[model samples]
Target: MSRWSSSLWIPIVAVAILIGSILTGGRADSDPQGRPVVVYAHPPCPPDLMRYFEEAFADFRQSHPEINLQVLHITGNYEDKIKVMFAGKVAPDVIFMYPTALPAWVELGALRPLNDLLGTNVADYFAAGVRT
Candidate 1:
């Protein structure tokens, strides 16, 4: 693979496994049928980028048979839609936001500090800035 594609792998892998790890706690199963549903909501991306995410999630689904993975690519007016979701007290298990929106969400207390649960793992997968 080219250097560019290879570089994308680390973050993609992190995001894929993060869907299950962060939300599932240690149970790995929510329903009596024994499969926890994991929903990840991301803003719309270019076709290529979305393809990469879908491929990564496909791999994640195959690897984690115990979890049901649902990817929601929210299209158009992402920020507004997300705000409406929070207003309605509806949110996905995993949410992806750009750097600019991060502060607002933090202020609204929509996100929780994962320091206890993730420890150094976040640092290991994400950039230094994302940790803060």
Candidate 2:
């Protein structure tokens, strides 16, 4: 699979965890009424995969009726757009990006460390992905 294809699960898993946390009142940063979680994904996805993403979102919505979720699919120049969003302090809660960009985002404090959010379950992620 292409790197992007493999990386797709990262956002899905993150979303699942976020929804779970919200449902159980495990995420302190989230409001009791549940805050909207904005997700940003890049293009180049196959039609079938896009369908899967939609299905996942639908399931999430059904399971967590109180949570507001928004997905933005970025087309050309995704990195630049993400940078602009960060500059405007409108970065999405979930971001799909190339691993190479992680360091810069981390340095800029645009990304949160997921160790606490993910806990030991993070070991399930690929070593390279964990590193990223």
Candidate 3:
């Protein structure tokens, strides 16, 4: 065919392939589960507690093999971590916090309100505790 016809065919074929790929959901990682879910815990959370969390998550993975859980320890300045994350628009899905920080997080709107999930009478929680 003519050079112009050949050139035109190349572009047409490229466009067709591009559109076909888009229609077919293109290429993706083999795992549909996506990135591992992250849970943040305050630094110095006692090795035992950390071990427990890991063990519990391992059990969870055994039953629900699709999801992968990652636990991150905040070594220093937990507040700074939260601040940076909020500013960067990258926030952890879950956090294990000591009770002292809870009020501040609530004021900052950093913590999701669990009132709906927990129902009322949250005051019924322990009057005092190690974490509280």
Candidate 4:
């Protein structure tokens, strides 16, 4: 996909809960070198979990050949590190965020709503997702 279509978000974010929600703040469009880069930042995790994350992205790359997806593994003080990144105005396009931490990031204006792009109601998603 040339752009982040609503459908792609699901498979892209299936890594697990700590990789919970996606927050897009910087450099989602074409990069300075004129290439599209989408950075996915997350805290360090166990090897197997990290493997799952990679596998998902492998699928993502296959499906979206035009977008350059980069994964950033931040060690030590994940939340604080993310804050520093945001302070520098260099937040990753997709960051691993806890649902509780979401309120704070939302306040910091670090998230972009995809309800419109999704074209699906939240209720419908939870209803289906939970059963599966």
Candidate 5:
């Protein structure tokens, strides 16, 4: 089995959130080489959830101001979007997805490993919220 097939979605989300946070001004100072991070969300999130998410993203940006971020809204099948994104090599630096979809991505090496970022015990993450 390949290394990526070992299940490492945490790093993907971490990188995505990190990149998202940076672009939104979470970190005040950053290097010029930092690349812009793109974020995608299914359109029509509940208004209350959208408000909460905006606040959360705002908090994240405040901590990483140096990174750039773009939030794209999608209106079609989530899997289809993911398929095209990966196939076209335009996958976002981070994405929020259902747990069932991860194994396939792991097998495809479509995500980065969290071991290098959060170290071991990454699996200790709670199943609620981000872990799912």
Candidate 6:
């Protein structure tokens, strides 16, 4: 795997958890079932990693079955795809993107600030990780 892909694996799972929380309001009994949470990521993984990724999602589903997850792996130009998604009003609830693209997304009003969601636990993230 490339350096970017390796580095993103853990964070992608983290984002999935966050999405689950957001969709279910952190409550399994919140009637979150059937609510769809779309996720857009790049460069489909190799077979082994793909199995692992699917397993992770399966585990999440076991706990939060109400929230439906739709994951899309893009192999072409990610930025262009993202732009098209936003323009078409079909952007994913979670996007696995390189940090470098954040500013442009923010400037275009395509991204929402996550500060409120992160709250005082911001220190839990690495300084470099939060910088993006």
Q: Which prediction has the highest TM-score against the true structure? A: 1
* lDDT for residue 19 in candidate 4, whole number 0-100: 42
- Cα-based lDDT for every prediction: 0.77, 0.73, 0.65, 0.76, 0.66, 0.71
Ranking by lDDT: 1, 4, 2, 6, 5, 3
Better of 1 and 2 by TM-score: 1
lDDT by residue (9-124, candidate 3, tens digit) is 99899999877766654433234568445444445567878888778878887876665555566777877786666544455667767777778887777876554654576666
Candidate 6 colliding pairs: 33-66
Worst 10 residues of 2 by lDDT: 22-31
Q: Which lDDT tens digits does candidate 6 get at residues 1-132? A: 698898998899999986776665533322355475645454556778788878887888788766766667776777788787677555676787677777888888988767678888888988876775
Clashes of 5: 13
Model 6 misplacement above 4 A: 1-36, 119-124, 127-132
Q: Least accurate stretch of 10 residues (summed lDDT) in model 6?
A: 25-34
TM-score of 6: 0.57
Each model's total of backbone clashes: 0, 0, 0, 0, 13, 1
List model 4 lDDT by residue over 78-130, tens digit each.
Answer: 98998877786777878997777877998998887755655655566766433
lDDT for each residue of candidate 1 in 1-132, tens digit (9 for 90 to 100)? 699999999999998776655455523335666688787888988998888888899999899989988777899998788777666555677888887888899888888776777766674656775548
Error of 5 at 100 (Å): 1.8
Model 3 quality (TM-score): 0.52
In model 2, which runs have C-alpha deviations exceeding 4 angstroms? 1-35, 119-132
Tens digit of per-residue lDDT, candidate 2, span 1-132: 799997998999999986776565432434457665545455557788899988988999899777766677887788788887677555677888677787888888888877676677876888876775
Tell me how candidate 2 scores on lDDT.
0.73
For model 2, name the residue pairs that clash: none
What's model 5's overall lDDT? 0.66
**Candidate 4 vs candidate 6, lDDT winner:** 4
Stronger candidate by lDDT (1 vs 6): 1
- Give the Cα error of residue 100 in candidate 1, in Å: 1.9
Model 5 is weakest, by summed lDDT over 10 consecutive residues, at: 22-31
